[model samples]
Target: MSYTLGVDIGTFETKGVLVDASGAIIAQATRSHKMLVPQPGWAEHCAETDWWGDFVYVTKALLCDSQVNSEEIAAVACSAIGPCMLPVNAAGKPLMNGVLYGVDTRAAAQITELTERIGADLIMARCGNALTSQSVGPKILWLKQQRPEIYALTAKVLSATPYLTWKLTGDYVIDHYTAANFSPLYDVNKLAWTDDLAADILPLDRLPRLAWSTEIAGHVTAQAAQETGLAVGTPVTVGTIDAAAEAVSVGVKDPGEMMMMYGSTIFMIQLTALPVRDARMWYAPWLYPGQHASMAGLATSGTLTHWFRDQFARELGEGAFGVLAREAADSPKGAKGLLCLPYFSGERTPIHDPQAVGAFFGLNLTHSRGDLFRAVLEGIASGTAHVMEVCRALGTEPVRVLAVGGGTKNAVWMQATSDIGAVPQIVAENTIGASYGDAFLAAVAVGRVLPDEISVWNPVARVVQPVAEAVYARQYPLWKRLYSQSRDVAHELGGGA
Candidate 1:
């Protein structure tokens, strides 16, 4: 039987999975990696040491465990986080560690510069996006100003997913789903890179070849085959960002569907008839050709919990999240009048400010660890609620929200999200996040399964409905007010990024 391989490069880990043509997972492996924070705002990754290192280790682990011959692997696909900018030498060698996505905001000054020079409205009109930590254009400008020598010898710029694809096939290609986010470098109306507009920003020809997310970029080479333990000549499909791929893994096939990814950050992707161009929300091409996906995200979700556990409950160990979640779930709906602003990494969607700081409001001496913990959970749910409201304001409410990612393992968080969103969240049976979807893309490429067959492998694990409307109605307004009030203080404290 033919097989497909999906590799997902994430902030905290690299995951690889092997699945049969019918979408049954045969083997799965994970290799944890480190997120480098040389400075508070500068998050980076060693493309060679960590990424390639973890990749080399995990590929063999998965294939060996699956007992599947390398030649049986019909196709390969990769998905990773992005809008990330990485400079590579002319020989396709990395010049520096891979700069991260929104989490790393070292280029905040560059963002301000670009917004002033090009004008936000003009940029929004041309690129369908506003200046934020997530866009690549400003990051590239930062490289030019900060590391001119590296920028001079740069052969191409790449995002996280394309970097992996290039390593596999020796072909530098990026999908439109990713290229569209390159901002001023991409002409929204024309749907192609514009040499005239970005002549001063990026090299026109050095940019990776663009394709739809399903298009096969090239075949795996003997070099990649040796490292990955995969057959040479296996077709490699161009993959999109982790958020987009997760949407595909959970069966976001039609319009009016939303995918909620719960990981290092919280993100929402809703399929829309036309691209939504709000400065608060983002518009990206979906996995299919000519389709658009609307995106919304918060800077902190799971990370806040991780921080709480690491910084506060170090003694609790393995059961920290579960223990805290249980305490929070038992607490009152409002967590006894405490609210958390989940701007720990600054905010993403709806408020693209890196200067925002996370806070706890209405805290009193009477508050216990349970109340604080629950409020933190509720706070992230509230942030997601804001995204749902934005989607509604943009003229689409998802009929059903499909939940995927690490946070899905926590039922309390899932319920909290559904309660705040006021929508039913259907948890997927297989929630391996983007990697699973990447494999599905490979399955499509190899003709092992039709694009429509995704639903067969993706079935719901459970469903949850909103809890209380009155509580959410009051909380949302307060959440909105917090942004304006917190921004000034956040800037003063230099808390963003």
Candidate 2:
């Protein structure tokens, strides 16, 4: 049987999957990587090692584990943590470590500078987004101004997926969904690149050509085939950001259906019938043409749990998150009245505050590690609910929320999100997320499958229903107040640092 290969580079891992024509996974493999924090507000990944290196390792592993012939693979696709900023040389080598997504807030100054120079209204009108940590335009400007040495040698700017596509197919292409994150550089109405907002960011020619997620960009080269164990000249599609692909994996294509990705950060994307033009949330064309998507996310989610485990549950050793989940589950609904702000990487969406600091309010000597951990989960849940509130205010409440990612395995976190957000979540039968979606997109690109067939490919496994709780009802408000009341102090501390 023919097969499609899919790979995705994540914040902390890379996963690859080989699937048959019927959407059954033949084999899957994964590789771990570290996210570099060179400074307090920056996040980076070495493109050669973490991005492309993990990809080659995962793809070869998938092929070897499945014992699948390279010629049997019909097509390949890739997705990754994006809307990132990576300047590359003429040969498509990364000039520096790849700047990560919204979690990295080093461009706060550039964001402010561009927002003021080019009026916020104009940017919102043309780009369909407000300048925030997620916007790649500011980061590009930061590179141009702060690292001119690298910028001068830069031949093109690319995100994670295109970087992979280039390495595989020698094509510089980006899907529009990923391109939209380059604010002031991408014009939403025209679905094309633009330097009208701020020409000084970089020349438009330095960007990758735009294509749809399901469009074939180019064929895999002989060199790439040798490294990846795929047949030479295999079709590769122009890929998208990890979250959008994850959304597609769970059949979240209809308007009002949302995908809440519980990954390193809790990212949410809601398909909308029309552009929900607001600066509080981001808007972008969907993977397909003429479609729209609205996005919101918290600055940190699973990463916070990682930090907590490293600091508080070191004794548990491996599977610390699982052990921490049990401890958190034992804590009361509101974590014994403790409230937390999951702004360790600064806040995003609804409240676009970069200086926002993480805090655990109502902490007392009586609190246990369980209470603190529970507070952390609840804080992330509260942040999620805040985003849902914004979507509702914009009259776009999701018909259903499809939950995906490794964090979904954390029962306490998933239940807390639904309970605090007062929203039911639908978990798909296959939780492989972006890589699975990439395979499906690859099949679609080659006309092997239709988009709507995703339902038949992977049906719903179970649903997480929101349980009403008086504790959450009372504590969520305080959670909001905890951030607002301490905003000044948080900024002061952030500044002093």
Q: Give the winner by TM-score.
A: 2
Clashes of each: 0, 0
User: TM-score, each model?
Assistant: 0.96, 0.99
Candidate 2's displacement at residue 323, Å, is 1.4
lDDT tens digits, residues 112-231, model 2?
Answer: 999999999999999999999999999999998899999999999999999999999999999999999999899999999998999999999999999999999999999998898889
All candidates: CA RMSD (Å):
1.7, 0.8
Best by lDDT: 2
